[model samples]
Target chain A: MKDILTIIFRLTVACLLAGLVMGTVFIATDKAKKHNVHVNEQKVMLSLLGYSAKNPAPASVAMHEVYRYLVGEGEALAMGYLLPLRDGSFSFVTIDLAGGFVAQNPVTLAAEKAGEAEARTAAIAVALGADKPLRYADQTIVVTDGGKRTAYLLPGKFPGFKTFIGAILAIDPDFSILGLEIMEHEEDPGLGAEIDQEYFKNQFKGKPLETVKKLEVVKTPLPEEYLKALEAEKSGLGAAEVASIQKQYQDKDIYALTGATISSRSVTNGVKAMVKKFAYRLAILDRVLAEQHIATPF
Target chain B: MATDKTNLQLVVNGILNENPIFRLVLSMCPAVGISTTVMNGFMLGIAVLFVQVCSSCTIALFKNVIHPRIRIPTYTLTIATWVTVIDMVLAAYLPEAYAKMGIFIKLIVAFAIITMRLEMFASKESVNASFWDGIGMGLGFMFGMMALGFVRELLGMGTLLGYDVLGFKPLLFFVLPLAGFFCVGLMMAFFNYIEIVYKRAKRA
Candidate 1:
């Protein structure tokens, strides 16, 4: 009885000591942890925007000025605070350009509105079974400075990959492609990484929706006869006009990565789907801008 | 085993003969996990050194009063307390290192080396002896981690402690976990070869 009592006494003392020490440590470090997280979020945002500098600012003046200039200043939305998923594995942050506050943990907000968006897209796809079914998130933030409205979608996954792909599609409110940015990819470093280069992504820019649908990587250039046919259809063109117009239909001569043809095709198809879905919205945004008498450099 | 050996001998033993990874093979959980980079290995080593020395001394000082039946649990709680303290310190002052180490910092509690040394040596040894043993073992663990990290960073990333080395063109395969296993395995073999030669010389 005495031995058992002594064991219990020892265990109790050890447990109490351990709890007291751990509690003190947790209390001491809580503030620092929060500060580190804030700084890390800023760094991640800068990297996503393709800034490669190690420290964002010098040690002399305030760093907040730099952050404001780079990421823009506004009240951070409460809902934008990234929360750990139920499984405690991954977290996501959402930036709302239109609402002027970045919203974190958009997965929860997305889940809330998924039903309506799903129904609408499903109805549209079902009606046009001939056209491919493309899924797009609702409540995306559209950034508009003057006349141009640019919508930035969050990085999302495509089929046949375990990791998410980061892509940004910029459309000129008139349903024409202005630019495209693929920030990062994990497909195959050198081979698949080529998708981010201007040579590949530039094909989409300045292309209208109707003309973009016929885009394909062809080996042989289009014959002179096809050019003659296209030119003859639209007459009364000056020398400079003919040259510029002829340059527009030049083949989108994208060379596929040697062994990574599938990955290359995946990005190409992803671009097409994104353009097709946003074309109508781009037109609507253009109409809105025109009505407001905004002059945008498209 | 020489009782008359000086502090320098103890240091050498910690780094070579009594290496916590290759020789003793304790505290491998963090050794393997945080050994991908020199910075991570160095920080983890410091953290482990602090915990091992403090906990060993505490355990040795209180060895007389602790009941045998609940001794293991008592040692665990004591080690856990030290780990939490170290974790908090890292988070507060060394936030970058803490963020990089991430979940491994918390897992320091489960490192077998701390509890093993406490139960096997510290509980029966003098306070001074336990302290030195902790230092030696901690240094050994640190050295092993750093060695693994150096190879990985240099070969895999073509950088040493994040500095560009060999003109920055690196073999990507070395940065992955599989390369870590191979590097450590080859290093252990090299250590074993040295040990064999030393043992033969001593016998002669």
Candidate 2:
């Protein structure tokens, strides 16, 4: 009994020491880690829009962050978009469950608080001047080029083979997919993880929002011609040939990775759902903005 | 009790006679999984090296006070603490590498190579000796991983650290899990053969 007690005591001491050490490290590195993640995410957004270190995004390019929130509960539920106005302030535009404009309220939320969902929600609750339960849903970035909207960079997440796969989808003004950049995933390497490869991810490029809404994953092997076209930049194919190939398979289903059907299907379904929902929300937002004569930078 | 070996011997033993991957046959899982690319192998090796050294030194320092019956748990706690610290540091400073080696870094806590060294050497040795052993073992593991990565990436994808060396893939089979095992087996045989031949030549 005494031996058992001693063992337990020793184990507890070790646990305490481990807890203390980990806590200190977490506190020390938390801010830096968050900053790094934010920087990497910004880089991804720029790259997805065809900007890179070598060919930097133009000085006229502007990225406006828009936050989405699920407001209220049950029957009183509504969707709110915290939009940036042309004058550099913010407004919370609320739409009812039936896609009707409900209310618009000017809200003040610090830019740094964007990473903290609770803080954003609290700020929104105060602005709403109501007891409605609010939950921050997701964020979309509007990329503009000198007062002209270029692309919508939407962040999305869905379950992959192992865990959730986080990705950023860039869409043009007409809702055509500009590119897909996989940010995070735990899918098996050389199999499911191939989704991040250029050939696989670039397949989504040029796909319109309408086609993406019905996109499906086919188990058929990706054709040699199609694969070559998908890798046009590397294979040195002319822009005309790339466009022809894309047009040829524009309506066809996404070809699943060789042995990663689940992963392929997950991405296809996730992209479809995200694009469809975003289109609906944007339509409502546009209607509400027009009726209220409120000019948003987005 | 195993601390009789000189510092140099401990390191040499880890890299050659008692290689964690080839001779000791420890940590085969990661050695096979992440060794598909040389960069990945090197990154994982660095993370493992940091954790192993920290855990071994911590264990050696506290061995006297830790109860013998509960030593395993204490060693595990030390390893987990160090692994978390390294994981956080990597994510903060080297986000690119962290993204590539996300879950694998956390899995380091369960590596048998670490626990085995802590049990067989660190728990018995002086703090200074254990520290050297950890270095030796860490470097040996890193060497093994890089060697496997070098072979696998070259043959599997005809690339060396993402550069196209051969211009065409030599064998796609080498990139698969089966090929990983085959490469490990072949390398193991090659190491053993060299050892046998070296011993015979020395005797002559």
Candidate 3:
């Protein structure tokens, strides 16, 4: 009994000492780990938007101020007022008017510093004079180069095969996909986790949002048409033919990852769900303008 | 079991006479599991070397106080603590490497080779002897894993340390789990054959 008691006492002491040491290390490194995670997230978001800089500067997007955007006010053109990108100079952009929106939107000021909707709104009212009194939220982070609004990114997460996959999807001013970058996932690397691979995600690039509204996953080999379209895409002369092929397949289906059908479908479905919600919200904003017989919110 | 052994002898014993993988045939799971790539094998070997050295030295010092009745749990606690510390520190400092090896590093706690060394050698020997033994055993395992990883990666991916040595893949079967057993078996036989020839040459 005494021997047993002595053994137990020594083991307990050793464990206590070990526990104390581990706790100290954990506490020491906690803040750095959190900072790394946030930076990695921002880096992934920026990379998707074609901005690969380590710090990429900061951007603030004002979705609500965009909601009540003044039309033809001080060189501002509106949404759905089509301009075919105008070759080399997509000069008419949301980014230039961004200066005006930034001056008007207080919530955007707070969003530039931190996230979380309620916290930003409250902080903005306290920091800036709230004559408009902070109603629905409008926040943005728009990066511009030579007066052209290049791209925009939205970070989101949805159910993956065996985990919640977080990713940042980028779209253009014309609501076409700029890129898709997976940030985190826990799917089987051999099969389901190929979602991170460029071969799988490259399909999203340049796909119009109208096509993404009703995405489908086709479980089969790459269709010959797509293969032909890819070959045509490389040669500059086949541009019109490639566009016609795209029009044929556009909204039809995306190829499923080989042997990771569920995982492939998960990403497609999640993207569709998120894009459809954004589309619905845009319709509401457009309807509000249409009711007053306004042509465009540009 | 030589009492008046030199430091060199103690160290060489693990690699040549009593190899954990080939001679003793201990801790084969990780030997096969993580030896998928040379990179995987080398990294896991590095982690195991750290844990093995840490636990062995600590166990050697506490041998007297550690009763036989509770030695298992005591040794386990020692190994687990070191593994956790490495896991956390690597995650905080070297996140990319940690993200790759963290899961495998945690699995090191369940290795029989670590606890086996504590019980078989450290408990019965002087602290210095056990420390050298730990280092020797760790080096032996690391080299063995790297060898396995080299062969596996070469045949599996036509690569070495991720360098594409072969322009085309020779055998994809070598990358699978089943291929691990075949590689370990063939390598074990090859080592044993070398040993038999070496002994015969010495006797002659």
What fraction of the true interface does each of the listed models get right, in terms of native contacts kept? 0.85, 0.85, 0.64
| Model 2 vs. true fold: TM | 0.93
Off by over 4 Å in 1: A39-298, B1-7, B29-40, B152-185, B198-204
Error of 3 at A204 (Å): 2.5
Q: What is the Å distance of residue A26 in model 1 from its true position?
A: 2.3
- Candidates by DockQ, descending order: 2, 3, 1
Best candidate, TM-score: 2
lDDT of 3 by residue, A1-298 (tens): 8887887788789889899989998998776777777778666766676457664544542121122222233444432211112121111112122322222222223323344445544554554454423343232233354445555555668899898988777776666777787878989968988888765776676678878877789887977666566545344437787668766766567799889999999998877765665555455544543453333213
What DockQ number belongs to candidate 3?
0.63
iRMSD of prediction 3: 1.2
Please write out the lDDT profile of model 1 over residues A46-150, one tens digit for every residue: 443333486453332211100000122244221121222333222233223342333221133332222244543443344324243233443332433342333
Q: Is the docking of candidate 1 incorrect, acceptable, medium or high quality?
A: medium
DockQ values of all predictions: 0.54, 0.81, 0.63
Clashing pairs in 2: none
In model 1, state the lDDT of residue B37. 89
* Each model's backbone clash number: 2, 0, 11
**Weakest 10 consecutive residues of candidate 2 chain B by summed lDDT:** B96-105
